[model samples]
Target: MSRDQLVTLAQALRELGGAVPEPVPSGAREDSSFSGGRARKISVSMPEDLSAAVQQRVGRGEFSKYVTEAVAQRLESDLLAELVGLLDEEHGEVPEDLVAEAEGAWPDVE
Candidate 1:
C-alpha cells in the first residue's frame, strides 16, 4: 500500500479505539494466485460413511474440493449465527447509547 493510504488507515483504526503499530507480515506470497497459477493441495476429514458416499458420488479426484467447499460454507453460517447472538447479548435490540443519540431515530425502520 502507498504511504498516504497506510497513514489514513492507521488513523481510521485509531479513531475506533484500537492500538496502532501492529506488525505487518512480510516475505510471504500474499498475492492472489488466480490467473494461470499452480494449484495447491489441501486436506480434510469426514466420517467413514460420509467419506465413502462422497467418493462414490464424485470419486476421490473431485471429492476433496466439493467436501471442503461444503464444510467451509457450513462453518461460515455457524459463525455468523453465533456472532449475531453475541451482539444481541452485548447491545440488546439496539445499543442504548445509539438509540439515545437522535430522537425518532428508528421510527418505522425496524
Candidate 2:
C-alpha cells in the first residue's frame, strides 16, 4: 500500500479505537498476541466489486494475511466500542465542555 493509504487506514482504525501495534515488551514473543492457533481456512461472501478491489490491493500469496488483519481490526474495533458503551452506561453522559476540550486538544483528529 502507498504511504497515504497506510496512514488513512491507521487513522480509520484509531477512530474505531483500535490500539496501534507496538513493539513487544521485554521477554514477550513478537507474535504472542496472534500465535496460539493453527491457521484455518474459511470462506466469505462479498460483492464482486469489493472482492476485486481486495484482490487488486493484495497479491495471491498475501490475500489470507490481508483478510486476517482486516478481521482482527474489526474485532478489536467492536470490543473497543462495547467497552466505551459500558463506560458510558456506568458513568452517564460526558459533559460537553470536556468533549470540546478533548477535541481542541487533538484538533487534527476528526
lDDT of each: 0.50, 0.59
Report lDDT (Cα) of residue 107, candidate 1.
71
Write the residue-wise lDDT of candidate 1 on 54-91 in tens digits.
88998767765565456535544544455555556655
lDDT of 2 at 55: 88
Q: Which sections of candidate 1 miss by over 4 Å?
A: 1-45, 93-110
lDDT of 2 at 36: 38
RMSD to the hidden true structure, all candidates: 9.8, 9.9
Compared to the true structure, candidate 2 yields what TM-score? Answer: 0.64
TM-score, each model? 0.42, 0.64
lDDT of 2: 0.59
- Which residue runs of candidate 2 sit more than 4 Å off their true CA positions? 1-37
